[model samples]
Target: MRWNNATTGRWTHRLIPNLTPWLQRRHGQVDFYLTQMISGHGCFKEYLHRFKHEPNPYCDHCGTGSIEDAEHALFICPLFVRYRAEAETTTVCNLTADNVMSCTLESQSKWDAIANMAAGILKELRRRERSRRIQS
Candidate 1:
């Protein structure tokens, strides 16, 4: 579902407050990832649904029948287990599934770690999905 301007405003400021400044300092692929997150698209299930890329919004990658949004990719996808663990350690405190959307990282190092992982997650997912398309 496309969010109206008012809703988007609240979501960005409340749930992901540091996103605008973070995007300002990044470019290329990292910028792309942050843009995708902010806009709620890019290889994620709900985005795919809007364009009808796939019939169902459930996450096929994890085989758990969950919606494969950015949150799932960052904090819960088994495919990125190692990266998630690393992201957790790089931050001041352990990162949890909910923290991806709720908590704010107050340090550049922590933000960088998560930002890198976010981009990597998109890269990996795009690669896998591309390969799946090729194979089929």
Candidate 2:
């Protein structure tokens, strides 16, 4: 199944099985910030400001024209589309649907694989952005 936002949380809960231990092992401010960043609710002022911009902060790739939420960053970005194409067979389909019902149901392993691919794509995008900033 596709791991859209709603189902992604549920999938995380199901897969982790032992949230307390995981949290304890990773306990730190960095973990907290990462959680917020992944969930689209980090308290960072600059991050928040990005969503409030006039063009709606939609992804440059997908052109969703809405708040550049976490879902958009991870899934809807057009840049990721190219990344996925290049990495064929390792890419997960980003659910652009409004609800979880639209997500394709897949095995747990498949979902995990896709999630990992998504993470890698996001990391690459960040790396590209950093390189661009350094170049400018």
Candidate 3:
């Protein structure tokens, strides 16, 4: 299966083991936030540092000296704890890198809840990134 064999898009694969349901059910554009969360190729510090846009991959908000990869931003960042908690409560599922796909695919409401939460967090991250750039 392409799901297990692909080197990239592991995050996406984790959430969408079979594309049929997602393709058939999914509506509207994927949006900037969800694309970055799945592809790990957007404004994330780890991705930016990898591309030499950032000096370091560490999360400026968490203070734990952890790399600010998509997984960290999605699941572990205290900066977005409220958004994460709200999504969990709304979806009735514990969010995890491995389980996000399943949880989101559970229902239309679950999908909307997760997508909104992700958008909120990523948009804030993008805003913070832009502010840092302007200050520097």
- The model with the greatest lDDT is 3
Task: Provide backbone clash counts, one per model.
Answer: 0, 4, 1
User: Compared to the true structure, candidate 2 yields what TM-score?
Assistant: 0.41
Pairs that collide in candidate 1 are: none
> lDDT of each structure?
0.64, 0.43, 0.81
All-Cα superposition RMSD per candidate: 4.8, 8.9, 2.2
Distance from true position, residue 132, model 1, in Å? 2.6
lDDT of 3 at 96: 90
The TM-score obtained by model 1 is: 0.71
- The C-alpha stretches of model 1 lying farther than 4 A from their native spots are 1-14, 17-30, 96-105
Instruction: Compose the digit string of candidate 3's lDDT tens values, residues 25-133.
Output: 6643467777877787767898899888888899998754799988898899888999999999999888998788667777878878888888988888889889989
Scanning candidate 1 in windows of ten residues, the lowest lDDT window is 21-30
- Tens-digit lDDT track of model 1 for 32-116: 8756655556787656766887666677866647788766776677878887777778775566543653333466676677777
Q: What lDDT is reached at residue 120 by model 3?
A: 89
